[model samples]
Target: GAEADKGSLGPDKIGGGAALADGVGGGSALGGGSSASSLALEALVRGVRDDVLALHLDVLNHFQAAQEAQTRAMEEMQSRQEAMASEVASLRRQLSAALQQRDEFRWL
Candidate 1:
């Protein structure tokens, strides 16, 4: 819009805040500030973006580590549950054998 409205002589093309008079001049774009200020703003934005990215990466790493720890804990719990089930089954078999022996003794 700036280039279209101001023609080829807009201040934007000259990097000046105002137009260069009757000669073809590019006008300032949407009242934008000087190029130096824009560059500074860009640098500031870039720095902030970098900081956010770094923090995001850190969070991802922490989440990944936590997930891995939880997975290990779940696996350990599952193993313990299996062991307990096996022990219970062994105990049941022993109880059944004992009862059988007692019945034989009674018959004798």
Candidate 2:
């Protein structure tokens, strides 16, 4: 019954026990014997490293895109501010000229 229970545990239930029995456990769970487990561990590590590198690159790309968008927004805002400043200056000059004309006519 103990053997039957062990068999019934399955790979997922026993946390990769079947993989260990199959000589591909990466030597982390089962005892080390040959270079095959080492190779498997190396392959797993490489795969994880590649995935992390890909994620890092993706994040960098997103950050660069966001930075570019922010730069464009700032430039647009600066242009609008300059345009508003120019309009305000023109209005002030027109008001000053109109006041001068009014004063001259009143004195006449």
Judge candidate 1 against the unseen true structure and give its global Cα lDDT, from 0 to 1. Answer: 0.60
Global Cα RMSD, each model = 17.5, 16.0
lDDT of 1 by residue, 3-108 (tens): 3332333224434322212121222332355466665665565566556655665565566666767999999999999999999999999999999999999999
**Model 2 stretches astray by more than 4 angstroms:** 1-34
Cα deviation of 13 in candidate 1 (Å)? 40
Give all TM-scores, in the order shown. 0.65, 0.65
Q: After superposition, how far is residue 24 of candidate 2 from its true place, in Å?
A: 18
Show model 1 residue runs off by greater than 4 Å: 1-34
**Count of clashes, each model:** 9, 0
